[model samples]
Target: MRSKEIVIRDVEKTFQTRGGAVQALSKVNLNIEPLSFVSVVGPSGCGKSTLMNLLAGLDTPTGGVIEIGGERVSGAQEGNAVVFQRDLLLEWRTVIANILLPFELHGVTWLDRKDRTTNRQLAEDLLRMVGLEGFGDKYPFELSGGMRQRVSICRALIQRPTLLMMDEPFGALDALTREQMMYDLLRLYDQYKCTVVFITHSIEEAVFLSDRVLVMSERPGSVVRDIKIQLERPRNLSTRMDARFLDCVKEIRGVFQSQGVLAEV
Candidate 1:
């Protein structure tokens, strides 16, 4: 087996609010292997976003530590990329230009100026891979929510980061669109083979998308269970009908139910 790519060691995070000190995460330990897809499910205000922020170095932990590829995470590393719920595209830039934003911001002037042809080709290829080939010249407003999010995914991948962090990236889309995006993401994961740490509240989504699902308890959130999904890959809607998938959902649902966080269905 390959060595762990990301490790969170007894990690804890706290925030000081007007009310008092807020404990966001407590003793959260995780080991994510390379090229694996993991989803974290938790209740609202259960520190799911906080955990992502810590990993991204957007915020520092009050205690413990997080390591990426054996290096302590002080700030965002070059090997990681993040896609948030919102597309966060530059409204003024065309789709292809938006996909090229990271390389430009990183000051790769060679790619930015004299030899932009290669970068442009790469952007075109990525847009095509994400089903936005002909739409590359279109502005963000011209695309649908799913199409815009596909562009966002392309932008995240443009850097070819080893670790990808997605925080409720499909939460804003409608149910059908979200499901389609899930399949698209899986296809992308198959191609890139990058480690993914996905954050979401939906039990069904978590079960469908993860190699492992970590269930978190309420505020002062902690990992209550880490369930490895043994479902076959190249998963589609049919996988959801399998007994194993249903069992996994039921088991995860039980975890949330025990914590009084299961969504009323």
Candidate 2:
């Protein structure tokens, strides 16, 4: 049940807001295996994003320790990449440049001010993987919403990160775009097999992409359920229509309703 790729032990986080102290997470504990896709779901403001920030090392826990691959996550730890709801693309950079930016920042090509040969190839491969082939010269401003997000994902993947954490990365797209992105994401994920911790509000999305789904309670949040998804791999559009897939979605929704995070309609 535990693989030690990620370990969150008795974690707690508190913020001192203008209205005094506010607890975002409490006594959270988890163990994530390497190369597994896990999704976290809960109602809005249930500390889902807070938990992600903690794991990504953007913020430290007020208490407890979080270890990624045996190293404590005390600060912005290296070897992990995160994709948020916003694409966070640089408007001036070409799509290829944006994807290769991480290597550039690492001094692979910084001082020379020239893109490294190998880095450029890796960036190109990633672009092709996401079906953005031959569009590497395009700027972020030239792209549609989903295309921009695809570039963001390429940027994240170019690093070959030890962990990939995505927080509602497709939340802004139209329904059709979101579904297409999900399918593309899973294909890339299969090829890379990096450990993934995804955060989303949609139960169907969680069920579709995850090997396990973590359900959190309301604010001062902690995971209340860790539901394993029994659906087959390489999921397709038909997977959504499968009875087993629907059952997984329904089961996660049941957890939300039971926690009073949602009301029966």
Candidate 3:
């Protein structure tokens, strides 16, 4: 369970559509320390996803550089995995099969029987790690949204990624399920020592799960504030009640407040 660091320097991105030359990011510079959990929050169309895609190597930056573990990202790297807001699980496959799909697709098992055996055991171990023990035999359609998301997280981890990039992965669920998913995510992050770059809209979620929170401006987005979350780890629901936790949330909201995007903190 090795973790990797990410470095982004002077990153900029632009889109050429009928509107012509839409700048999404400007001079974005960030360094995600190894094995740390970092969250990015901002208003809609703020390029949070754009930055994430660049880090995941799903897209290329128009300018500057993005590196993972000291190596430049040219395209989708083998050691990086991404989970989106949507579960995107294959309804036809059972949960365990879905978790192992990456290995089959990447032909990890074709390397040798040893890799196959190791990954199968890893998949089951990760399933139980997220509290999804016996549900592995069930299909995606048989699970609730939160349960499906739990499976998705396991699927991502089964690849043993060094960098796990998520784009608002929990935003679609109901409020209670979202909170439960947050707890599950924290536990998984602790267990898997991978660098996480999470994108979210909730100040509370950002403060609760992140070692640091990066706030972006409205448009042509860039990092406006990189606030360190000084709270203790192994955070549960009660952590939301901690004074420092509340202050961290408030501090991030205050950044939005100053931008006139939020009226209250």
Candidate 4:
């Protein structure tokens, strides 16, 4: 099946703090095209993660509606998958076992590493897709931060979810590792063709990996600018240096600066 379209209309989220009701997002509306790579970039407290949680159905919106493939997002759907900054891998499980964990939750009859199930094959294929072909037997403790994240990516994709929501998945990696991981993610995204909504604070990373970039305002986070990245796809690390890419990054940062969320260096 193809990726599902996402429609979010007039979404609002508020939290009841001891001080008062703190509104995180207000009057937000979005329509995400199917199979597109989109990224949301904003200031630290701009409710980017909150919006993702609502879209993923992990939390309910205070107002407005979120729909995926014409179905209202009332709760977690099998067609939807989410990846957070943390890998959340099971320390006791091997790499392949971690990938198959989602399948095991669905109560697939055959989940054993020794079993030759199609599910296991899919898990193995995903690991190989991310260039971890021979790391299946290694435990998460034995892998580097980036390798562990790759395993988590494989785990998220093992079921072939149509809508993949990732919240700062590579935030913790070092500069070189993060750059390589971004490349790896783009490669997997091309092959999987899933509709991805990525939330990040890095403007350049947003421009490099996204087909369209959404810039949000601070506090009451709403998309203030929907910038289309015109850079040629199959983007590599060098794409970051392209003139158009830099322009997009600058434009996003400018928006933040205008909002007082960022300032001159």
lDDT (Cα, tens digit) per residue for candidate 2, span 1-265? 2223899999999999999999999999999988899999988888999999999999989999999878898777667899999999999999998998888788684555345776787888998999899989989999999999999999998988778999999999999999999999999999887889999999999999999999999998999999999888989989999999888888887887888877967
Candidate 4 lDDT over 141-201, as tens digits, reads 9999999999998988887889899999999989888888889999999888899999999
Candidate 1 to truth, TM: 0.95
Candidate 1, poorest ten consecutive residues by summed lDDT: 107-116
The Cα error of candidate 1 at residue 45, in Å, is 0.8
Instruction: List, residue by residue over 74-187, the lDDT tens digit for candidate 3.
Output: 999887889989999999999988999998897675769898788878888988888888887899999998888888888898888888999999999999989988988898
Residue 148 C-alpha lDDT in model 2: 97
lDDT of 4 at 83: 91
**Local lDDT at 247 for model 2:** 85
Question: CA lDDT of each candidate?
Answer: 0.90, 0.90, 0.90, 0.90
RMSD of each: 2.1, 2.4, 1.8, 1.7
lDDT by residue (tens digit), candidate 1, 1-265: 2224889999999899999999999999988888889999999899999999999898999999899878899988786889999999999999988998998888768634654778888889888888787998899999999999999999999888788999999999999999989998998988877888999999999999999999999999999999999998999989999999999999998888888776577
Residue pairs in clash, model 1: none
Number of backbone collisions per candidate: 0, 0, 0, 0
Output the worst ten-in-a-row residue range by lDDT, candidate 4.
107-116
